[model samples]
Structures are given as C-alpha cells and as structure tokens.
Target: DQQVKQNSPSLSVQEGRISILNCDYTNSMFDYFLWYKKYPAEGPTFLISISSIKDKNEDGRFTVFLNKSAKHLSLHIVPSQPGDSAVYFCAARDIPGGGNKLTFGTGTQLKVEL
Candidate 1:
C-alpha cells in the first residue's frame, strides 16, 4: 500500500484565486512534509514545507499545513496565477539514518486559467 496519497487527480482555478491541494499519509514515522511543483518536462522544484513540530508554515503566496494527528497535509496558494499551473507533489521524510529519503504522493495537476 502507498504510504502517501493524493486522492484528487487534478484541479482548476481562475487566476488571482486560491488553489488548494490535499494529501494524506499512513506513516506516523514521517517527521517532515514538503510540497513540490513540477513542469511538464522538468524535475519537481521544492515549494513549501512543514515539520512535525509545527502546524503550519508559509512563504509568500504559498502555505503548507500539517495535521499530525490526522496524518494529513494541504497546500494553499493564494492569488493563483497561470504560471502556477503544474503538477504538485506531496513528500514526506522520516528521521535520517544513512541519508534523508523522501516518500512522494501521486501528484495533483493544477490548471490555472486566465
């Protein structure tokens, strides 16, 4: 079974609006959560992240929220722009051992319309 899941395959929003993407996880050992945005032919770029110690983290127009008790997390983008259209992936990492490894959820494609 997949430890991380993004139930929604896609979402659409008009420019200058808020876009919300949701994710869920089954692993309690995960201590770090992150959101990454990817273009069609490029690798994913890190967006926002939240640690298990915090409930929320924000950077400019992007915000990430983590609910440790529910094993859920969400990403919110305010004033979504057309350039924001891309596949968003949720990732989680446990405490490090040999290396910091991440488990990623199936991505959610977001379409921003003008």
Candidate 2:
C-alpha cells in the first residue's frame, strides 16, 4: 500500500485565484512533510514544508498545513500565477538506518489559466 496519496489527479485555477491541493499519509513515523513543484523535462523544486510539531507553515503565497492526528496535509497557493502551473507532489521524510529518504505521492497537476 502507498504510504502517501494524492486523490486529485489535477486542478485548474484562473490567474490571481487560489488553488488548493490535498494529501494524505498512512505513516505515523513521518515527521517532515514537503511540497514540490515539477515541470516537464525538469526536476521537482522544493516549495513549502511543515514539521509534525507545527500545525501550519507559510512562505509568501504558498502555505502548508499539517494535521498529525488525521495524518493529512494540504497545500494552498494564493493568487495563483501562470508560472505556478506544474505538477505538485507531496513528500514525507523517512529516516531508516540513519539515512533519510523521501516518499513521494502521485503528483497533482496544476494548471493556471489567464
């Protein structure tokens, strides 16, 4: 079974609007949660992240909310821009054998329209 899941395959939003993406995890050992944005023919770039100790974290137009009790997280983008169009992946860090590894969820494609 997949430890991380993104139920939505895609999302669309008009420019200057808000876009919301959701993610869920089944692993309680995961403490660090991150959101990455990926473009065609390119690697995913880190976006926003939140630690299990914190309920919410925000940077500029991007925000990440984590609910430890529910094992859920959500990413919110305010005033979404065209450049923001990309596949967003939710990832969690797993430290096993003293090594840190990331488990990523199936990405959610975000399209921003003018």
Candidate 3:
C-alpha cells in the first residue's frame, strides 16, 4: 500500500473542549508525516508535520503525536471552536531525497458545536 489512513469520516466536539482525531498507516518506509485542515471547496492547508525521528509536534492550539511502534498518529485541538469546523486530513510521504510531497487520507469532517 502507499500508506497513511484516517479511518474517521467525521467528528463532533463541543466548543471549548478538546477534539481528538486518530489515524493509522501500513507502510513502514514513510518518513514525513503531515496533518492538513481544509474548508469546503478549498485545498488543505499545512497544519503540522513530524519526521520519523520525532514522536510529537505542536503548533499553537494544535498538537500531533506519532507512534512509530504502533504505526499510528493523532491530532489534538484544545479549546475547540466553532470556527474549527472543517475537514482534517492525515497525510504521509517518503523523504526519499528530501522534498515536501505527500499522500493524503480520505479526510474527517470535524463539527465543533457551540
């Protein structure tokens, strides 16, 4: 397989709470991990990324943790807001020669309720 998978198609969370999204992968050769957020009719925007050498990466209100041993990863958003409602994609790519290419998941639609 090309690798990378986000099993959830949607998620719902109340505003001001934490939203946790899960992802998994099969290929062991993937070295670069990225999470992207998208709005309807728009392209995904880079959120956070991690290398095979690290297990965690954080940016502002978002945090991503990777588990190399389990071949899994997750995204966490604190104080989830209504504005956070959108599609989230968990993506992966191999840094065969050092580049920002990627393979994306089906995506998950997160609805933040007020």
Candidate 4:
C-alpha cells in the first residue's frame, strides 16, 4: 500500500498565480510529512515540511499544511513562476520502514504557463 498519494498527476497554472498541490495518506500513524520539488534529471530538493505536532509551516513562497486527524497534507506555492515548473513529490517518514527511508508519491508534474 502506498503511504502517500498525489491524486492529480499533472496541474497547469498561470504565471504569478498560486498553485496548490494536495496529498493524502492512509496510515494514521504517520508523523512526519515533507514536500520536494524536482527539475528534470536533477534529484528532488526539500521544499517544505510539516511536523505532526504543528498544523502548518511556511518558507518563502512555499507552505505546507498538515491535518493529522484527517491524514491529509498540502503544499501551496504562491506567485508560481515559470521556473517552478517541475515534478513535486510528497513524502512521509514513519515506523516499520526503519532507518528513516522516505515514502514518496508517484509525483505531480506542475506546469507554469506564461
């Protein structure tokens, strides 16, 4: 079973607009959530994260919100830029996997139209 899931495979947004990517989890025990952005061949870089203890966290134009009760999380990108076009991956770290391996979603490709 996939611990994390991105319902939308792709999303397109206008330049300078806000893009919201949603993710859901099945395991209620999951405690940590993270979001990563990738550009083509490069590896995904950590964009934002939200701890189970907190409801939300923000960094620059990126924000992550976590709802432990609902087992849902979301990443919001404000003023989406053309350069922000890339694949986004939602990840979670929990027990039973051991060694802190991140469980990831298939990925959502975001396109910023100018």
- Model 1, span 1-114: residue lDDT tens: 899999999999999999999999998988898999999999999999999999999999999989888999999999899999999999998876314788999999999999
Q: Report RMSD for candidate 2.
A: 1.2
lDDT, candidate 3, 1-114, per-residue tens: 636788889999999999999989987878988888999999789888888789999899999999999999999999899999999999988767436678788889999999
Worst 10 residues of 1 by lDDT: 93-102
- Compare candidates 3 and 4 on TM-score and give the better one: 4
Q: Which pairs in model 3 have colliding backbones?
A: none
Cα RMSD for candidates in order: 1.3, 1.2, 1.7, 1.2
Give me the displacement of residue 42 in model 3, in angstroms: 1.3
After superposition, the stretches of candidate 3 with alpha carbons farther than 4 Å from their true spots are 97-100
Model 4 segments beyond 4 Å from truth? none
How do the predictions measure up, each by TM-score? 0.95, 0.95, 0.92, 0.94
Give the per-residue lDDT of model 4 (tens digit) for 42-85. Answer: 98998888888899999999999898878889999999999999
Q: Candidate 1 at residue 80, lDDT? A: 99
Candidate achieving higher TM-score, 1 or 3: 1
Candidate 2 weakest lDDT stretch, 10 residues: 93-102
Candidate lDDT values, in order: 0.94, 0.94, 0.89, 0.90
